[model samples]
Target: MVNILEFIIRSKALYTTWIYYKPNRLLFDVGEGISAALGNKIYSIEKLFITHSHVDHIAGLWGFINTRNNAMGSREKDLEIYYPKGSKNIEDYLNFIKKMNKYLRFKLYIKEVEHGDIIPLKNNRCLKIFKTRHTPGEKSIGFQIIEKRKRLKPEYRNFSGKEIKEIILENGKDEVLEEYEKKIITISGDSLPISPDIIEDSDTLVHECTFIKESDRKLRNHTSLDEIKKLLTYISPKRVILYHISSRYNRLINKAEKELTESFKNIEFHIVHPEEISII
Candidate 1:
């Protein structure tokens, strides 16, 4: 069976964060310490998507670019980075990185994307961006991987398997199904509880659960475990991988994970501990 998601992720609130999605060679948020963790695998990444310019979310860019250019690996593989369109901080930081690496050996491309924008990928998949509420005056976004497919239309759902096969054999499959898009994965990059519609029916959701305890949150920016639970009441995802958790919740993490698993029996739950890398 094909793996739904193959990723190495590390996240700690206010510290550093990054996700290396192996299937498509996509890296999300090049936070500090990522280079030391990913090492040679950095050369395999084709694109890096930044949700925002917060230091914790982007501090690794400098090291990543420098390492890929100088480290013992192929230097000809091109690297493309996509960030929110209105993020001036990321634009400036990318400029600084380019300036510092004047003798770079590879092609470094940077593009600014916004909500409702689509970035095409290989294997009939694409990435879509949606606006998110992170910090006041800071423009943040979330990403989802959508796949184009054809599925049986609602009007054809009641047909028996044999009858459906006969219909398809006679009329062709296109006559029984309609073209649609399926959201296979989503990343909630350091934002408030993502809207339910944005994540509904996803195969996997990599959401930021920064505050395990609701009372610990002072601002409306970061998400809490309670919010995630509430969000689940509206939509169902096959897997919910929680990350970017605060270090102070080390003791509370186990208990929270147990409860989450118990309550959402159908959804697999994963917690990315602060001090270690989670391979999934």
Candidate 2:
């Protein structure tokens, strides 16, 4: 059985948005209040994957960088950050951060990433990036965690235990087993409903639900609960976490969650209330 992921997430449209994936010490989008939310744990983050340069999504990055440099924690650890390639806004902001902290204590590494870039991680896992649609003129992307797995080949699956043992002993285990990729998680950084084709085989999906009511959204850049419902019909994941929500529907979250649970019986639903931090 797959283990449930542990995460700390907060998203309030045009205010702040961030997610801390505990298992990998990975922080996605360094929005405002991140330093306060994570406290000293901010030093534990080894890498950061940014989706875009929106102020609400990356406002606290300077605080984050400064805190780690002076905070009372592990100070020598190097920090690596990856942002969407060709994001001139992000580049300019990063340059400002460097100038502000001229006497930094630790090393800071930054990279510009584009679609199809694969960042290898420990435990046979990798982080893959893909493009996402957001505000016009703003470059954005999404992330997926994929794992390498081995399973019995199709031709050997129906064999009896004894037969399989004999075949393995004769031909070696590698001959009967095949390698495959399993998408562990998918995070849709602030965007309209992401494509179902990308999240089809993923176990967990962390998507933005900016407008609970489709009628409330005037711009086509964000997604709504109704659109998410339609998207879920195309791909079924074990869990769906809705974040980057607008504060207007704070009182209606429970009702929406209840409805989705009834509709997607086999999938777990988690909504990150915009007013508070959500730990799951």
Candidate 3:
């Protein structure tokens, strides 16, 4: 069976929580305010992938922990959190949460992830964490969830099912009988003009676009519409989700959406608002 993957774009700030099942279920990047509240009701999130330690990105970390604890005995597994190495005071953050929730029953396992590390999941799927250009002060990382597939080997491409089965039985388990394939979904945290290579040919690319006009090019640490336009030359993502818009541009969402759709006809661009959920 194929896995079920869903990305929920909750409130502002590069906050997106992803739920993927087929393997174990996991959530990524809990943002500030009501985003975590919405995530609490979705699933028993067992794993969390954090991009960075920014306040807007990690503010809901404590709330999520508290919500899991309040579930009584419903949580049957430990919650594991993956964050970039040398990013921030992770130890202190964990200690503070533990101190605040003294009566919590479940265990929270915090793991430090490095660039190019693969986090194994159930059903042979894995998440590959790659370094990003965002948040240079602290080590920031991007996530790519990879789904593994097996196809008949080139030599057996024209063979019948029975023949394939026969070969599988004749050959040992260690024999390579098929070709492997991977489908990657990459998400970029808040960054200024991330390289298109980071998200090249991704099934879906979720990126932050804080500014929509060319005059806003001077803004630091945020991507502008011009920057995203430049990326289109190198990246051909099937779906392009623009998120983390500043509250000041709330009224201009429709205008931005229309302009983007007119500019990029081959790709679908979606503007994510607070409490809005999008499945990719």
Candidate 4:
């Protein structure tokens, strides 16, 4: 299953944060340098989920869209860019891009999503949007890739496949099955510490740990390592990848990671170093 598979690619992050989930061919953000860093790999991106319209998080939008339009060997797949509803920044940016890139070869979809909105993906999967406390009144959001499935309800748990088939023939599949959702990936786009409930049971969480020390955080809307420590107490994802670190902490990240690795023994921890490409 694609959910059980893992393939880390040479992707970029940092002041500009974006995570490419290879299995889904989805890009989280389109920060500057993303097109250059991902190079030809950018062509594979079918969907982009923008958490917010901050310049660093979306500066590369034009480059990506234009590249796909003019670059050789580009696929004609429709590219969907999802952002929080009422994001004036994104709204204006898209309007400008649409006028500038008028003779595009493929479809460029710009969608505005609100909290609790679900965007469908391939193979019974979807991207679920939720609110995040980032810049006040900025309508920032987070995303989770979930797989929807139907499983046998408790009352039908004891039945064999043949028995279930016989029962389905008499009744219906809906009578025997119950819908459930499994979290595949949770992405905390540039935001303050997110609520644990939003990311609960996620297989992998890509969160922003912008500041290692609380004092270093000049902005209250960004996340800090201290909050992540507290978050770890309740939220236990299979893996955690931290990104969007401030460049000032570039030299200290290794030591900080060493200490964190020693403290958190169960969950895998990864940091996307400042101004460098990191894959997980």
Every candidate's lDDT: 0.93, 0.94, 0.70, 0.83
Predicted candidate 4 versus true structure: per-residue lDDT over 1-280, tens digit per residue: 4445343322233447667888888988788877877888888889988888888888889988988888875758789888899999899998999899989889888789999999989989998999998878788889989999888999999988999999999998898999999998888887888888888999888888888889977769888999998998998887888888888887988988888788888888888888567765
Best of the two (3, 4) by TM-score: 4
lDDT tens digits by residue: candidate 3, 35-82: 344544533667888877777777777877777677544554588889
- Relative to the true structure, candidate 2 reaches a TM of 0.96
* Candidate ranking (TM-score, best to worst): 2, 1, 4, 3
Worst 10 residues of 2 by lDDT: 1-10
lDDT for each residue of candidate 2 in 1-280, tens digit (9 for 90 to 100) = 8758589998998899999998888999999999988998898898899999999999999999998888899988999999999999999999999999998888999999999999988789999999999999999999999999999999988899999899889999998899999999999998888899999999999999999998999989999999999999999999999999999999999999999999999999999998999989
Model 3 poorest 10 in a row by lDDT:
14-23
* Alpha-carbon runs more than 4 Å astray in model 4: 1-14, 150-152, 156-177
Runs with alpha carbons beyond 4 Å of true place in candidate 3:
1-5, 14-24, 34-36, 39-43, 154-177, 274-280
Candidate 1 stretches with Cα past 4 Å from truth are 1-5, 158-171
The model with the greater TM-score, 2 or 4, is 2
Error of 1 at 154 (Å): 3.8
Better of 1 and 4 by TM-score: 1
Deviation from native of the Cα of residue 165 in model 1, angstroms: 4.8
Total colliding residue pairs, candidate 1 = 0
- In the predicted model 2, the residue pairs found to clash are none
Give the C-alpha miss distance for residue 203 in model 2, angstroms: 0.5
Q: Model 1 over residues 120-205: C-alpha lDDT tens digits?
A: 99989999999999999998999999999988889989989998999999999898999899999999999999999889889999
